[model samples]
Target: MSLEDLYREVILDHYRSPRNKGHLDSPDFRAEGVNPLCGDEITIDLAFDGDQVSQVAISGQGCSISQSSASMMSEAIKGKTKGEIEDLTKRFRDMMSLDGEADIGLDPDRPGAVLGDLESLQGVRKYPVRIKCASLGWNVLLEALDGEPLT
Candidate 1:
């Protein structure tokens, strides 16, 4: 099968059986975001081990792109320091072309090779309308990173 087809399959797999799809009873940080344009919403709950993310739980409702993005983000950020997660977030945003560029520092030909399964979402950029759907989870993650801890 083609690379594009492979990526599409990866996305579908994540959507159908998402990882970290739940809630944390006590999260160090938590944030929720909504894409009013498309009604995609995501809530990120983080449990940190000092400066690193020890655990992550995500509960939300949205399209495949948004939900799968959350699943991928949860996998990528676990056991990562806030700084590392921030860098990964920037790299992911770059891949999404949200910052006017898409330089993920790896060969786009071999997507799953790096960034876990996130690069699979790159194709969403082709449809500008779906970009937000693809990034709704990342946006919520950023808010959780920068916002105050959950009370």
Candidate 2:
């Protein structure tokens, strides 16, 4: 099996059985995101301890890319500080961008360099239209973290 095949399998696994797919009893922050183009919608609920994210839950209806991305994001951001989440968000956006090389901004020397399975979605960058589909959950996550009103 090739690397692309592995990434596809990872995405399919996450889509079929998502992680952190639910809601919290009383979340500190919540935001919803929608992609009008593809009709993907997601809601993110987050609970924070001090400046770190204590817990996260997501409920959504969307394509495999959106749902799986949300699942991957929920797992990746758990126990991370707001700064780390923001940085990850930036890095993820960079990865999704079509301009220049796709550097996920993860340094191998760092603790979380692998980006877990989230890197599997890097292939989506080739499909410019699907980028928004994959980013739906992440955009909602950023909004929730920023205390921005849901759109």
Candidate 3:
């Protein structure tokens, strides 16, 4: 009915049916991130074909916010080129900051037509503590892209 309700539904959907939630098999890169404050942890594995991310996977356990955010992260970057994925990652990070109304790395005209429900986490700006929870997997994924081991 309302936008908040829609966001809640989106979050719930991701939490209930997590995407890419498993171990990596011969992954090209992997990285892990932990939020000591909340004990939220995530490890992401990335497989790149040249500059494109051919596949992404993860294994982790945490609160619904962390796990669902990880699910959304995996889904958003699938089939995306390295540059495009990086742009989306920046956009997602900017959204979490709620710095302004600009879509940052997104096409302002189209918004998140492609990212779909995953964009609902923009509301996370309201919960400062949960910001790290939502970013856990994304940060780890970035490390994987950088060819760093999961720390």
Candidate 4:
């Protein structure tokens, strides 16, 4: 299959069968994010075992991009350490931003390897408004991890 096809499949699969798409009994951290223009809202809960995130979950209503991004975020960070999560967030943000001048230290190829088919969403930059939808989960995750509001 082609790269675009692979990326589309990754996104569609997440949208169709999201991971961590519900509430947890108790959470180590929680954050809520909303994009008023698109009416997408995400509530993220994280459970940490020491510095490692033991569990992660999300509950919300959103467009396909927002919901699927949340699912991918949950799957990506569940067993990672805070530092690793932060790094991944930065890489993902940089990848999505597509700011030619941005100095994201890591070679996009290595991390993009893990991003797998989801990398196709990099084209999301072409749709300015949809950017927020794609970033909903990322911002929420950062806020929850930092114990602060995202805005």
Candidate 5:
């Protein structure tokens, strides 16, 4: 199997059986994000342990890219401190960004150098319009972290 095939399989696996695909009963933080252009929506609930994320749950409905990306985001953010999440978010956004400015040494040839399985979704960059679909969950994550209201 080729690398692309592996990425596809990873994405499919996450979409079919999303991680943390639910909601916390009393989360410390909660927020939602919507990509109106593609009708993708996501809600994230987070519980913090001191300065770190102790738990996360996500609820949403959308395309495979959106849901799977949410699953990956939940997994990545767990046990991450506020600063770590911020840096990871930047790297993830830079990875999905069209502009060539990944200051964190994220080379396209080595997309997984920072994000682990989340890198599998880098293919979404090929479809410019679908970028929002994949980023819906991440945006929601930011909102929750910032204590922003659901939208």
Candidate 6:
């Protein structure tokens, strides 16, 4: 299958069977995000240990991009330090900003440049409108770090 097709399958898989799709009873940080344009909403709950994310859970309702992005992001941030998560978040935003170029640092062969399954969503950049859908969860994650009240 083509790379794009593979990416589509990955996204679909995440959407159909999301990871960390639940709530944390007592989370250290929590934030919710909504994309009014598309009506996508997500809540992120994080538990941290001395500046490291020990666990992450996401609850939301939205399109495949938003849901799958939340699932993928939850998996990525778990067990990561605050600094690492911040860097990864920046990298992900940079990836979303790509305008059809292969500069998101994704290289299947190289492997090192790949952002795991998160890179699969790179195609979302092609649809400018969908960018917000993909970024909803990520933006909430940042807000949680900033101690903003989630609505």
Query: Could you say which candidate leads in TM-score?
Result: 1
lDDT of 4 at 100: 50
Best by lDDT: 1
Clashes in predicted model 5: 0
Between the candidate structures 1 and 3, which one is better when assessed by lDDT?
Answer: 1
Write one digit per residue (lDDT tens) for candidate 3, span 28-49: 8888888887777888888877
What digit string (tens of lDDT, one per residue) describes model 1 on residues 8-77? 8778898999999888999989999988887887888999888889989999898888999899889999
1-151 per-residue lDDT for model 6 (tens digits) = 3546435988999999999989998888898888887788999898887778988999989999999999999999988998899889888888888333346657778643568888888778777777888888989999998894232
Q: What are the per-residue Cα lDDT tens digits for candidate 4 across 5-99?
A: 42476787888888988887888889899987877999998888887888788899877788888898888887899899888887778867734
In order of appearance, the predictions have TM-scores of: 0.91, 0.85, 0.82, 0.82, 0.86, 0.87
Backbone clash pairs for candidate 4 read none
lDDT winner between 3 and 4, please give it: 4
Please identify model 6 stretches exceeding 4 Å from their true place.
1-7, 98-102, 110-113, 148-151
Question: lDDT tens string, model 2, 1-151?
Answer: 3546335888999999999989988899999888887778899999888888888999989888899999999999999998999888878888887435477565645634567788878778777778888888888998898895222
Query: What TM-score would you give candidate 4 relative to the actual structure?
Result: 0.82
lDDT of 5 by residue, 9-119 (tens): 889899899999899987898998888777788989998878888889999898888999999999998999988998888888888884464355656787577678988
- Candidates in order have lDDT scores of 0.85, 0.83, 0.76, 0.77, 0.83, 0.84
Residue 50 CA displacement from its true place in model 5, Å: 1.0
Q: Which pairs of residues clash in candidate 2, taking residues 3 or more apart in a chain or in different chains?
A: none
For every candidate, C-alpha RMSD to the true structure in Å: 2.3, 3.7, 3.6, 4.3, 3.5, 3.2
- lDDT score of model 4? 0.77
Backbone steric clashes in candidate 2, count: 0
Q: Is candidate 1 or candidate 6 better by TM-score?
A: 1
Q: Is candidate 4 or candidate 6 better by lDDT?
A: 6
What's the CA error at residue 16 for candidate 3, in Å?
1.5
